[model samples]
Each structure stands twice: as structure tokens, then as C-alpha cells.
Target: MSQIIDTSSRAHLLDLFLGLRPDTLSLWGKMEPQQMVEHLIDQVQYTNGKKIPFLEFSEEEAKLAKQKNIYTDLKIPKNVIFGTLPDQLIYPDLPSAIKQLMTELDDFDLYFRNPETTAIHGAFGPMNYKEWIIWHSKHFTHHLSQFGLIAMT
Candidate 1:
């Protein structure tokens, strides 16, 4: 099982975002910049009140995401991966998405102080809060790295 991100690691994730560019994400996934942004926005929405249908997983999908493998380490399943890029950037107009995600993350960090609030996998499965954070951080970073937004300096 993977560890979840705690308050201490939030800063690290924020730091990772410092120099992110929209272009670098192209290399990691087929989605275009706008699609990538929209994808992330969807994630934020999921975390917030907007509930999308849980990603239905086939036997292969479940088998692929095993106990040891972090979510970021696994390839995005074909079912959910965007098929086509949008013509325009969607997130810029939806600043609330970013704000909501940040707010939820902040709440998550604060909630962690009460050990009872341990991370619980939403639709995926069991995972500590730290693991959830790491998964999200890594997942986002992986895409950002793919797009050429953030590079190892």
C-alpha cells in the first residue's frame, strides 16, 4: 500500500508546480493542453461536490492497479483517457475548479491532524491520506512532465 500526502508534503507538491508549463504535458498523454487542463479540472470537480460516475474497472484494470503500484505509476486506463483534445483551453474560464481543488487539498491537510481522518480511496479503494496525496501529486506531475511543463533542472 502507498502512503498518503500529509501537511508537510503539500509544500513539496506546490513547489513542483512552480515552473509547470502547459506544453510539457503533451509527451505523457495524447490529450492536448486544453484537454489536459480540462482533465485536471474534472479531477478537482470529483474531489469537490461534483460527483462523476466512478470509473468502472474491468478485471484487467483492477489487475493493473495492484497494491504496490502507485496510481501515478500506472498508465491511465483507455476508458477514461481522453479520446480527443478540445479546441480551446477550458480551465482558464473555470478558475473555480482550481480554487476548489486547492481548497479541498487545504482541507485535507488540516483534516489529517485528526488521525481519524485517514485517507480513504474514493472510488478506487483503500488508501491512506498520504497515499492519496502522493497519488494525486505524482499523477499530476507525471502528466505535467509529459507535456514538457516541468523538467528536471
Candidate 2:
């Protein structure tokens, strides 16, 4: 299982972001390159304890998440509803967007290193630090694959 909190996987993700071109097209989702980066930053904000989730999950949903281990899945299914990115965080260019997301990812990594706080995920319910790591790794890979940076096998 590749983990975004792991140094190697982290570097791989960062390199992929850095390699993104402005005109890159998504293989599935509707987001442009900068929009994808901003969307990731929004997700990382939740992981970093900077945002509060409005959605709540039932115990059944949480238990199902654990049982299914959905985060460990290799692909994010097409046409899934992932929601929208906020207007404020969208960058004017791809490099700026990637830089912002990279910073957020670094902050997330630091928080995971000495996790002192807990946050609720909108769908997955309560997740510990390790679960967050696994989720981010898979989520990052899912989006990276959107731009063909990570090949789905």
C-alpha cells in the first residue's frame, strides 16, 4: 500500500504535480489542471484540521468504510460525486496551484508525523492519522491518474 505520508510516495506525488502542464486534460473528471490542484488542497485542508465537515455519517456507514477498506482501492470510480472546489483557492496558473497544494500536503505530512488532532471525514466518518494517510495516498493517486501521471494497473 502506497502512503502519501511516506517519503517516497510523497515525493512521487509532488513530482507528478510539478510535471503537470497547463493544458492537461482529465481522463475522466471535469477539472482542469489548476482546478484539480485546488480540489486536492481543499481535501488536504480537511485532513489538516483546517476545515469542518458539514456532512455526517451514520455508524453503519463508518463501519462499512472500515469493512470495505475503500481507501485502499486502486481506482476512484468514474462519475462519482466528489463535490466542487471553492472559488477562493483556485489559482491563476498551474504552477501556483501546484505550489499551494504542495504546501498543504507538506503541512498534512507534518500533522501526520505528530498527530495531535482528529477530524471527521464527510463520508468515511472518523479517521485516525493512519487512515487519513491511506486515504490521501489513494485519493492522490486517483487524481494523478486523471492527468495520466499514474497509470492504473
Candidate 3:
């Protein structure tokens, strides 16, 4: 699996994100181009422990998700809702959203460097840096494919 925490992988992901134009259409999801960028930034923030999730799964559910290694999975189920995104995160344009996402990506990189830091995913429960990296890679790929930025094999 490609890991997003690696510099080269991050660069590749960034390239795909930058390749998106304002009119890029989603292949699956409902998100527009700017909304997709915002969504990705929110994903990064969730991983970095900068934003708390609204999801409150039952103890048993959390345990099951952890046991299943949900986030680490290469492909997530499509059309799964990720809770509500903050209204403030909605950017005025794709370029602005992309720029903010780039900043968040940098923040995620710094956060990942500290092995001690771990974030609790809403569905996946608490995750270490390695787990976060894996999740982000899969998550990014999923959305990138939605925008036709990459293809899933």
C-alpha cells in the first residue's frame, strides 16, 4: 500500500490534487471540486487531532471497527457519511481550498513525525501515527478517484 506519510507519496498525492480544475466532476460522490478539497483538509485535520469528530459509536461498534482494521483497508465502502463538516471549512473557491489543504498537509507531516501522538478516529477509534498514515492514503485515493485524479486498481 502506498503510504501518505512518505515525502514522495505526499508529493504524488499533491500533484493529483493540483491537477484538479474548477469544473472537475466527481465520478461517485456528491462533492464538488472545492468541497472535495475541503473534505480532504478535514480528513487531515481529523488525523492530526486538530478537529474532533462528531461520530459517537457504541463501545462494541468501536471495538468491531478496530478489529476489522477499517481505516487500514485499501478500499472503503462508497457513500459512507463521515459526519458533518464545519460550515466554516467551505472555501470560496477551489484554489483557496487547495491552498488550505496544502497547509493542512504540512501540518499533518509535522504531526506524523511525533510517534507519541495518536488520534481517535470516529469509526476506527484511537490510532497511532502509522495507522493514520495508512488511513489517509486510502482515504485520499478514494476521493482522488472520485475526481478522476487517479484510478483504483
Candidate 4:
């Protein structure tokens, strides 16, 4: 069995977030600070409760995912657009978002220790808890890196 995400790594996540100065993020895209924050928050919410609409990939998208090995260790390329709602999409406040993400991440860590908890990923189909953890870690890190928040130094 694989080790789960360390929920106690709040300091690491916080450090990453704090390292993100506004100007560095602005270089990524047109998103405002609040919008980027909301985007991260929405990801946590979607994982915790709502089943985001999963679309059958276009041939192009599927080919790209396969070529890029999205299901494996490859990094999601920068500016390789997929589908997500605009950051203007309404969600809970920033504090609430952070709290929710923390709670869910903790819950996921616990779930990883149990054998029965299964997660249905949007693109990757069914996944065990360990797989889900890797997916979330990579996905979140991708976004954080995109925002110039964290570098794998």
C-alpha cells in the first residue's frame, strides 16, 4: 500500500500560497487574485461533494492526454487548456475555502488508509484512495506552479 498525503503538511501548503506574490500570478493569465483563489477553492469543493460534469474527451483531448500521459507521472503542460468554469464562478469565501480544503484533504488521508474508499475521477475513471491522492497532489501542484506559487526546488 502507498503512503497517503501528509495532512500535517499545512505549513508546506501555506508556504506555497504565501510565496505567491500577486504580480507573479498575473503573468499566468487574466485571472484576478480573488478569481485564482476561488479557482483553487472550487477544486476542493468539487472533490469533496459535487460530481463535476465529466465529458467524453474529444479525440484531440484524448490523444493529448495519452501523449502527455496524464494518468501517469508526466506534468500537465502549461497553458494546455481543458475545461473548467471561469473564476467568476461563485463559491464560499477564501477562509471557508481554505478550511474546506484542509478538512477534505484530511478526510482523504484517512480514506487512503482504508481499503474500501473508492474515488471516481473525472477523467481517470475509478481510482483507489492512493491513486486519488497522487492525482490530487499533482493536480494541485500543477495549478500552484502555474500561479508561480511553488517550484519543485
Q: Against the unseen true structure, what C-alpha lDDT does each candidate score?
A: 0.50, 0.71, 0.72, 0.56
* Candidates sorted on lDDT, descending: 3, 2, 4, 1
Q: Candidate 2: where is the Cα deviation over 4 Å? A: 1-8, 70-74, 85-89, 113-116
Model 4 stretches astray by more than 4 angstroms: 1-8, 21-24, 50-71, 87-96, 110-113
User: For residues 1-153, could you state the per-residue lDDT of candidate 2 as single tens digits?
Assistant: 332323236666677788789798889867778877888888889877678764467878876875466544545565466556555545778788877777887887666676556567777777777777767767777777778876765
Tens digits of per-residue lDDT for model 1 on 18-62?
Answer: 444444335544675545556665554444335443535654564
How far residue 112's Cα lies from its native spot in candidate 4, in Å, is: 5.2
Kindly indicate the candidate among 1 and 3 with the higher TM-score: 3
Inter-residue clash pairs, candidate 4: none
Model 2 residue-pair collision total: 0
Candidate 3: tens digits of C-alpha lDDT, residues 48-108: 6588764468767876876676444446666777676455547778878888888887887
By summed lDDT, which 10 consecutive residues of candidate 3 come out lowest? 1-10
Alpha-carbon lDDT of model 3: 0.72
Quote each prediction's TM-score: 0.54, 0.82, 0.81, 0.65
- Model 1 regions more than 4 Å off: 1-25, 48-55, 58-64, 71-90, 93-101, 107-123
Candidate 3 at residue 50, lDDT? Answer: 86
Higher-scoring candidate on lDDT, 2 or 3: 3
The predicted structure with the larger TM-score, 2 or 3, is 2
